[model samples]
Target chain A: MKRSLLPFFAGTATGLANGLFGAGGGLLAVFLLNRCGIDKKSSHATALALTLPLSLISAIILFCWGTTLPLGALCIAILCGLPGAWLGTILLKKISPALLSRMFGIVMIVSAVRMFLR
Target chain B: MNLIALGIAGFFSGICASMGIGGGFVLMLYLTLLAGTPQKEAQLFNLCFFLPIAAFSLWRHRKNGLLCTSPIKPALLGGIPAALAGSLLAAFLPNAQIAKLFAIFLAIIGIKTVFARRESEQSKEERVIRPTQKQ
Candidate 1:
């Protein structure tokens, strides 16, 4: 198996984000997928599928470390999010890529800015 | 590097996951962009790595106060079979269209999460119907 330099850094970035901050790791995954030449759909689908479990693992470690969270809200959002993700996928079928990209760029910049500013 | 990567990934996976977000994106980025694994391989690795990690983590959280299991039954009743049905159909779909759609979806979530600022609303929305509401 050939190893490359970039993905290692990508993993480190995500791991650090998870261990310390606990946010934006999913977005980081998509950024990697898009940047690395993976088709967008696979990136998203795979990202969604992949995150489900990773989040579970992350939660476990944090609990052991004695972190606190408000579970009720997350469950509602996730319960809503599953259907929402599916619904969003349907709507995406009719949307334009250019529009998506413009919005995506704005969101990415905004999210990063929030993290940086905070 | 592998040890470091795995260690870091495990740490991040727990923290990000408890927040109700996926850490896959971060892991994928690490595998694909940082480690230089191809996109496909990175994605596969993510799913494989995810199942056990997530299940175990959820189990741990359920024991603590961070995770709950009471609501899973109703949701799974409808979700489980549908996921299977959808997966079977997704098998024959086209790639280009899928990629475009994925991009669009991400952009919207990115926008929503980025622009929304009211944490109060988020907190209120998460509270379940009180036991009294069941009647």
Candidate 2:
């Protein structure tokens, strides 16, 4: 791929995944941004910056398409998440991302198995 | 799950999300597998839940000088239309099928995450100039 086109292509894939799954776009963004030669910290931050608009667009489309959003749950989550976000930023320096990633990966695998069996 | 449980899950998921570590996945899993939310609905919920958090995070990152604007324009150009197309495709798919596909995606990501090395362990040489710096 041409160097200039990398971000565009990365964005395409990230947007598609976010729209399709309603999640996971940031993961794709971070990975692709890193591949684009960005530093890890910037990759994470830049991925968020990139995905924010994509997610907004996706959410709007999903809403217009008549997906019944759990508004109450959404509100609760956001309300509680604000402080949690702060805590997470603090923990980011203290915690080992490698360990957290492994643990999170395990949870994802278990959840996938459960979903498959259901 | 009860409201309290949901709130607790939200709190923890928020922490992970802000950390840029796929907290949305954690919330989605909890909603679908534990809280009995439908796959599509859970996805929608996740999207909505993430918006505000992402905005806030972006603000902080910008203040901290972690943001790079050079890639954002091209990325958004490709992302906006693609997001619309993907949403349409998702909307047309049946719930069960979406669930199956989501499971597969989760599995793939899980495997990748498990095998991936920590960024801190990477050599300093991999850190390149910010795209903006090249301008």
Candidate 3:
């Protein structure tokens, strides 16, 4: 495949996962972008950008489906989440790669176990 | 078994994500393990699939009074530009690294959930409302 094609494939996967999971798009986007030859800084920025549109689109769909939600609570969460997200970004830089990877693995396993148990 | 299965997955995933637990872990696993897709490909498919579902869920929440633009707006300031850049960056990576990273992220979420207390199970933090002094 041509070098340019590589990015498309990478984008496709990142986009697919983001659309389906509604989480991890940021982290995974960076990983894929980095692998695709994008520098870390650009990859990080791009990954961060993806979150808004993806979340917005998902939120809209939920609305159409008529799922009940806590506007107040979500608002609080969003309010908290922004700072949390910003803080999280800063914190990520402080962690070692090994520990960070371990953290990531543990998160996934817990999520999987919970769903499986559910 | 095709579109229907996909639709159901999206719906369920949407519910979970809106609940703030994240749908990506489950979505990728289902696609890769149950549906027999390769890890890389499953992730690719799920990313696109998640967008609509998440958007709809957030919208639905707003209808139920869950929507708040307050924090989300600030996030958008940073998130939009970052995502575009990330998308562009993804074009150059190798597949193995992606898989490794995905696995790592999953592991972390799983551990946190396991040890973390459910909001319902825990006592709510008290929110203090103080009276203003008379001017």
Instruction: For all candidates, state DockQ relative to the true structure.
Output: 0.04, 0.69, 0.06
Q: By TM-score, is 1 or 2 better? A: 2
Q: Indicate the residue-level lDDT of B118 in model 1.
A: 38
A60: Cα error in model 3, Å: 18
Which of 2 and 3 is the better model by DockQ?
A: 2
Candidate 3's DockQ? 0.06
User: What are the runs in model 2 whose C-alpha is more than 4 Å off?
Assistant: A93-96, B120-135
Q: For model 1, how does the per-residue alpha-carbon lDDT over B1-135 read when each residue is reduced to its tens digit?
A: 264564565445433333224444445445434565533333334443444444544444344333323223332343334333332222233433322333444455466545643334534554554455556
Q: Between the candidate structures 1 and 2, which one is better when assessed by lDDT?
A: 2
Candidate 1 docking class: incorrect
Query: What value does the TM-score of chain B take for model 2?
Result: 0.84
Deviation (Å) of B71 in candidate 3: 1.2
Report the poorest 10 consecutive residues by lDDT, candidate 3 chain B: B126-135
DockQ result, candidate 2: 0.69
| Interface C-alpha RMSD after superposing true interface residues, each candidate, one decimal | 16.4, 1.5, 12.6
Chain A TM-score, cand. 3: 0.74
Order of quality (DockQ): 2, 3, 1
Per-residue lDDT of B5-90 in model 3, one digit per residue for the tens? Answer: 54455544443343333445555565655666644455445454444444544444444443333333334454444444443333
Cα lDDT of model 3 by residue, A7-61, tens digit = 5555455444443343476555555555555543344444444454754544444
lDDT winner among the candidates? 2
Across residues A45-79, which tens digit of lDDT does each residue of candidate 1 receive?
A: 33333344333444444444333333442333234
